[model samples]
Target: MSADILNSLARRVGDGVAAVRPAAAMADSEATDPVEAVATALLGYVSEPGDGVLGRLVGALGASGMATALLEGRSGRDIAGQAVTGLGPADAPSGREVTAGLARWGPRLEEDAFARSIAQAARVGARLLLPGDGDWPEGLDDLGVHAPLSLWVRGRPSALAERPSLALVGARAATGYGEHVAVEAAAGLVDRGLAVVSGGAYGIDGTAHRAALAAAGTTVAFLAGGVDRFYPAGHEGLLGRIVETGAVVSELACGAAPTRWRFLQRNRLIAAASDATVVLEAGMRSGSLNTAGHAAALGRPLGAVPGPVTSPASAGCHRLLREFDAVCVTDAAQMAELVASVGGGVGGSGDGDDDAMTGAPPPRRLEMLSSAERRVLDALGTRRSRPIGDLVRDTGLTPGAVMGALGALDATGLAARSGEGWVRRPPDEASVRPGSWS
Candidate 1:
């Protein structure tokens, strides 16, 4: 019964089925409310990346609450009320924006999307990384409302922060000179204890990833689509190799196709996941500039390599250096200096400051579960049942708190009344991995 509610709602509209509450409890619900993980994943599936309205809504209501609210056909104004109640109106979406957001998400919210997503991911051995997980890349917290809610990683989660990472980005039609420079920079950054990060596109991105792998260094490739498909079709073998040594990551769920907007949004992730971003080579309107912009906005160090004035392939890099105040870097040492200049903080995990523009909280600020919920859920088991008294004794929580959590969990399909006491749901029941992995 972990994600059963979301599945059951495939045809249902709204009935206030799941209890709506704050999210801090859900964040603390690592093992307790298996559906909480599914709920969060469902939110991502229903909405587009960088949707500030949905992002803040999830932050206020908790993913479970927000998911329930959406599934129940709540109005945007009504849902926005949660933010007004919890985090205040600073970042709450306008009723109109929230309405538009719901309209955008409505069609995408499919039945059993979470179940099928996790199943496919499991087949590929990909794991889901929640915002507050041990393996989560904290640097992405800098994006505020625009950050990815969860990361689908197809390889080593450790690759994200094996050390501070540097994003080497540029045009796909990279020149020989640009490829040579990317290779040198990637290998050198690897030797200097920095992981290499790039979108798994051809030319510069592929070149850098290959160089880092060839040098036996950790590298991470951020994809616009699901990690399951490994976009660009031609890079299948390359991505597979990364799965063996590093990681291939995405924000999209398994089986979701990539779009142009997703690719652009994916650039922000590339910039956010690393300590610094460098445009090895790009044309005048190269997409790497998008990555550089995100790095600059995030306060991550930005660098651009110089090239011959006559080479149109180098136009974007020169423009970045000239217009965006990006640093001029020609060699790997210079690029390493970009990472060094910023104290080597990956993903810009700065102090707890709300975003100036969007008013989004620091990373994972949107995901929270009450302490009582945490204790109660922690005490429940999927197969074995525990009575109220046993739970109070095991968790040291008051009977009232335990009972309240159980009620909330039961309402959300996290826990259920067994023959005697209580037991967790089907998320982790009889499955090799937790329901959230889906």
Candidate 2:
């Protein structure tokens, strides 16, 4: 497992730290070696979250060696060659992919940026957590190569590592019903002694964090940008409270800004860090669905609150329930049940086999369609035909998105073209049919 690389990296980090600060003084105050901390902080500056190439390289060469190779401007093919010798043949990256990844990373490398990140973290009293740190969330290890290189944390790191966690995510433009459900779910989970986790966005995410705090429960906010600069500027006060009472965490360094791609990538962390994920309310295109998808892919249980059928804000949740096999969760009790089922047991439930004890049904269908595809299916009539333009209006999707969804649905035999337009397919013969369609 590359023990030599890790041992060498540890010594280098310790030596580098000793050179900068008195070994005896730092030994008493810091939890991590200074060099390892600096190297990882620099890696965050240059690499994006979920960079499989960087993750594999670090796994093979250790963080210190990888940092040195990059700093020396070694070619990507050279790095890949070294990694291949350490990793199994099938697990290694292609030279072309590594080269392209290196090109993407090259422009972002700057020693000044790395130094600024470290200094700012120190000024803000943030701790740097590496793979083996006591406070690291082990659930993140489930991500394999996509796991974070390191974590920059504020507040109690125990908030993440010490308790079972659940992710509550939804639309940034959440409605009143959505906010109410989020608050109730968050408070209820806290009462059950679970830590609530979410991205620090407005609407549902903010509501959940606020509810957890109000209940005097632990909560953690995973950010897309640097922990030093909170996004959605309006949440500064709320984030300050989080830092004081819980934790605000980020994979990015102190100076990094939030971007669309980063936010999408950040959802996986929210899912991986939690025992389960709940979507309280969301549009068909809401980013929260992305979190649910990650949870499902990771084999984590997923739950969604059912909202009014007429409400666009709840479309994503409905889609998850119907197509993704997301458990139907209404209140805190149901939410707790979802976690209990996945966590083996909760409270005093014996032997973690509550489902068998309680005779609950096993989870169905382990996969689902994307939100866009489901929305198109939802728009079609069981017996009548609808044109693409009509579907676009009914689903509030663009013509291109609707057409794309229709094409996919048709390919999958879930919908088919008819003389008039398109119609939902008959139920498969092997499956039970419902009494009636609404």
Best candidate, TM-score-wise?
2
CA lDDT, every model vs. true structure: 0.73, 0.74
State TM-scores per candidate. 0.73, 0.74
lDDT (Cα, tens digit) per residue for candidate 2, span 276-323: 888899887677877888888888899999999999889888989998
Off by over 4 Å in 2: 1-32, 348-438
On a 0 to 100 scale, what is the lDDT of residue 239 in model 1? 95
Question: Model 2: which ten-residue window has the lowest total lDDT?
Answer: 351-360
lDDT (tens digit, per residue) of candidate 1 on 1-438: 424656565324222112111133235435234456667777876665776777788788888888888777788888877678877877677777777666656655566555566667767777767776666788899888778888888878768756688999988888999999998888888777788999999889999999989988899999988988988899999999999999999988788666544666788889888888898998865667777777888888889999999999998788887877888987877787888787774342222111132211111110233545644665577899898877764444446657888898787677899888999874433322211000
C-alpha root-mean-square deviation, candidate 2: 12.6
Per-prediction tally of clashes: 10, 1
Ten-residue segment with the worst summed lDDT in candidate 1? 358-367
Could you tell me how far off, in angstroms, the CA of residue 424 lies in candidate 2 after the best superposition?
40
